[model samples]
Target chain A: MLTALELIGIAAFAASGALAAVRSRLDVFGVIVLALTTALGGGTIRDVLLDVTPPTALVTWPYLAVAGGTGLLVFLFHPTVAKLRRSVLVLDAVGLGLFVTGGTNTALALGAPPYAACLVGMTTGIGGGALRDVLLREIPLVLRREIYAVAALAGAVIVALGDHLGFPPEPVAVTGSVVIMGLRILALWRGWNAPTAPKLDGV
Target chain B: MLTALELIGIAAFAASGALAAVRSRLDVFGVIVLALTTALGGGTIRDVLLDVTPPTALVTWPYLAVAGGTGLLVFLFHPTVAKLRRSVLVLDAVGLGLFVTGGTNTALALGAPPYAACLVGMTTGIGGGALRDVLLREIPLVLRREIYAVAALAGAVIVALGDHLGFPPEPVAVTGSVVIMGLRILALWRGWNAPTAPKLDGV
Candidate 1:
């Protein structure tokens, strides 16, 4: 079940990445590169921070195959894929939730400190999209006026708290994931925006 | 001797980063962040790839101190630093040389394959600057028309070949660094550029 959820998340992220590349009018190779980065970049960073050699994403052929295949599909059918933007956004929220919870659990299992685990979890949830935006020469949405990182950080904190307080891992994971997804979806529905820095005349 | 050289490279990169931040009109905190990222981002990525946990930059107080101190200095003395841009660029070339050679040697020592080591070397030479540009919402110069990555790759190839041929490590490292620095400086002086993709009418 966990593997299935992970694969779904990877696919969703890959699709979103491909769609973004298509919108940017990148070539097929660029689309594939973006898709793979978006799908696997976060997990790779998380694994590196936790000292997991080779990164699970790199060793697991399924992750590469799924991300690459999704990229190709989107490149060939971009018109149809573009029409599914709403669905992709909803699926991306699901991906973010799964990544944050799973990353936190992994860090905790590896005996990382609570604060470090929370940070690792947040990095895992947001790193890929941040990388994608960076490669596209744009400020990352998480670092801009978006509630995305806040939601991920909140989920990470919950997971870390659960682990610290001796709660059941399974229920805590589920709750954390739900909270992230719920907050993200609600923010979207309500057109909520994170606050930006106030305008100043000079430094 | 090697430690002193490494510190010099770190300081040079940090200064370059801080100067860029000043040019962008970032506040003090932002300037410091950019300086650290520019100074240590490449080594951090290389360490992560080689499964070096916590990263050398994170564990070593000297690295952090040098970078942060350089940032503070640049922030307080922007006009003076701006006047020294030419010297900074030369020092940046030196840093690129040291990082590329050092990164390749580190990767080879860790039992990575030759091709992977070469790529890692190039990444180590260019990664920090790439991150700086990405954070600044600009396309990385290495990925644009700059001859930067090419010079790094050429140096890496030489280092890898020398290692495969059982050459003395110190001499080989010196040769590689000299080649990279020479090539970069020459490119700057001669106004050489890497080729860009041809404009296409349609996808």
Candidate 2:
């Protein structure tokens, strides 16, 4: 079940990356690179950090096929589908929730402590997006005023706390994911943001 | 001496990032972000992969200061500094050489295998710039034209081979660094570019 959600998230994220690449005026090659990175970059970092040999994505072809195929499809149909950008953002939110929860869950399964799992989850959720922004030369929305990673952190912490308190894994994950999605919507609606760059002062 | 050179390289790399940000027409904050990432992102990645506690630059004030401070200076002097953009490419090449050699030396010191160390060196040399390109939404030089990472790889391989043959560390490092710098310049001057983006029609 969780793996199913993760795959969905991957596809959504890849689509988002492809859309961004198109908006950035990239060629087909660039679109593919962006899609692959958005879909795989976070998990790749996590696996590399955990020393997961060969990486899960490299272990099979489906992951690559899904990300790449989805990206290509989106790239080809973007002009037709772009009007649905708002709907896509909602899908992006779902993916974000799943990714953050999945990341934290995977970390815990690997025997990381609650705090570490939560951190991993946060990284998982935002890592690919951050990489995407970096490639696009845009300020990462994570570091900017976006309530993006913060929401993931909050949800991960909740899920981790639930697990630590003996909650069943399934419930904890679902609860956490829901919390993340809800919070993201709230954040957007409320225009929540991190503190702006410290006011520049003449030293 | 190594520390001084590292600082200089960091400054130059940061300046290069800042200049790239200008070419992309980013705002002041964006410029600073690009500068810092260009100078320090690769090392940060290396530390994270190695699981080093605190990561060197974050632990040490000077390295952190150099990256960000250089960005600040470049941002303040954008107009004047932008005029030297062409010359900055020369400094960028020099910094790439220093970075690759430094990364290779550090990896070797950590007792990594020659092949892995060489890869580490190559990654460290190109990682920051690649990241900067990614952020700017430009095609990464590593993924596109320029013998950029190829130069680092060649230098890293040479140093590794020298080490295996019991060559003195200094000579190996010096020659290796020179090889990278020389190749980089030749590639830049002669328009050497790696193959990329094979046709998508078949697959």
Candidate 3:
């Protein structure tokens, strides 16, 4: 079940990355590169930080195949993909939720402290999109104006708390994921934005 | 000698990152964060890829101290630092050379293939700066039209070749570092630019 959800997340992120590449007018190769980066970049960073060498995504051929295939599909039919922006955004929220919960669990399994695990979970949830935006030469959307990181952090905290309170891992993970996805989707629908830093003069 | 050189490299990269953050008008905290990222990001990535657990930079307080100290110094005396742009550029080249050589040797020691070692070396040389540029919302200078990656790759290949032919490590490392630093400095002085892709129409 986890594997299936991970694959779906990878596909969603890949599509989003490919679309961004297309919008940037990148060639086919660039689109595929971005797709792979977006799908695998977060987990790769998380694994590395957790001292898991040869990151799981790199060793697992299925992840690569899924991400690359989705890139190609998006590139070949970008107009159709673009038309599904709303769906893609929804799917992206699902991906974020899964990544946050999974990342928190993975860190905990690796013996990371609760606070550190929460940070890692948040990083995993947002790392891919931040990387995609960076490569596209834009400020990361999460760093700019979104409830995105906050949503991820909230879910991560819940997962950490569940672990601390002796809750079953399975139900805890499900609840955490649901909360993240719901919050993200709600933020999108309601046009919610995170507050930006106030400007100061004469620094 | 290697440890001293690595410290110098870390300090140089930290200063460079801090300067960039100041130029971008980031706050003091931002300056420090960018400095730490630039000084350690490349080696951190390289270590993870090479499957080294608990990255050396994270474990060694000296690295953090040097990077953070440099950041604070730059933040406090940016004007003096900015006036030394030429010197900083030279120091940056030195850092790049050290990182490339160090990264390649580390990878090779870990039984990585020569080609992979070379790529990791180049990444170690350029990754920090790339992250800095991305955070500042600019295309990475290396990706744009610099001979930066080429110089690093050349140095790495030379080191790999030395290892393949069973040369003693010290002289080979020195020779590699000199070659990378020389190429980078010469490129800067001569305004050498890497070739860009030709324009293509209609995908």
Candidate 4:
């Protein structure tokens, strides 16, 4: 079940990347590269930080295959894929939840301090999309004005805190994932945004 | 002597990052973040890839101190720092050489394959600036037309090849550094650029 969820998250991230690349009018190769980066970049960074050699994303052929296949699918039918905006958003939420929980759990397992684990977990949820935005020459949405990172951080802290209190892993993971997804969905539905720096007149 | 060179490289990279942040009109925190990222981002990524636990950039207080101090300096006197364009470029080249050589040697010491070492070495030279540009919402120059990555790759390949041939480490490192810096300076002087993809007049 966990494996299935992970695969779904990876596919969703890959699709998101492909759509962005298509919107940017990148070539097919660029599409694939973006998809792979979005799907795997976060986990790779997390693994690197945790001192996991040969990151699972790098050594796992199946992960690459899934991302690649999703990219190809989107490339072939971008018009149709683009039409599924609502579904895409939902999938993105799922990915955010999965990555946050997974990243936090992994960091904890690796004996990272609670603070480091929370920061790393939040990054793992947002880093891939942030990187994609960077490649596409846009401000990362998470940094600009989204409840994204806040939601991820909340989820990560929940897991970290629960683990600290000696709670069972399964319930904490589920609750954390649900919280992130719920918050993300709620923010989207309400058109909510994190506050940006106030404008200083005549600056 | 080597330690001094490394510190100089760190300071130079930090200064470059700070200048860019100033140009981008980032506030104080953004300036500091960019400075730290540009000074140490490459090495951090390289270390991660090599499975070096607790990235040196994160663990070594002095590295952060040097980068932070340079950022503060640039923030206070950006006008003067900006005027030293030639000096800055030279410093950048020096940093590039040191990072490329350092990254390759470390990867080799960790028993990474020669090809991976070469790529990692080149990336260590360019990653920081590329990341800074990405944060600033600009396409990385190395990916566009700059001869930057080419020079780094050349230097890396030289080091990796020499190592493979059982050459002395000190000489190989010195030779690689000189070659990269020389190529970069020459390229700048000649206004040379790596070829861009041929224009599709009616895409």
**Candidate No. with top DockQ:** 4
Q: Which tens-of-lDDT digit does each residue in B116-161 have in candidate 3? A: 9999988888888888777887767788645788889899999999
Worst 10-residue lDDT window, candidate 4 chain B:
B194-203
DockQ score, prediction 3: 0.20
**For all the predictions, what are the DockQ values?**
0.20, 0.10, 0.20, 0.22
Q: Which residue pairs show collisions in model 3?
A: none
Global CA lDDT of candidate 3, please? 0.84
Predicted candidate 2 versus true structure: per-residue lDDT over B96-148, tens digit per residue: 88888878878888889988888888888888888887776667777865488
Cα lDDT tens digits for candidate 4, A88-198: 777888998999999999988887777668757876887788788888877666644347766897899999999999999989998999999999889776653435333
Clashing pairs in 1: none
Q: List TM-score per model, in order.
A: 0.59, 0.56, 0.60, 0.60
Model 1 gets an lDDT of: 0.84
Give fnat, all candidates: 0.33, 0.15, 0.35, 0.38
Candidate 3: list runs displaced more than 4 Å.
Answer: A1-44, A48-105, A111-122, A141-203, B144-146, B191-203
The candidate with the higher DockQ, 2 or 4, is 4
Order the numbered candidates by DockQ, best leading.
4, 3, 1, 2
Residue runs of model 1 more than 4 Å from their true location after superposition:
A190-203, B1-43, B56-130, B139-203
TM-score of model number 3, chain B: 0.92
Relative to the true structure, candidate 3 reaches a TM of 0.60
Task: Kindly list the interface RMSD, in angstroms, of each predicted candidate in the order they appear.
Answer: 4.5, 6.4, 4.4, 4.0
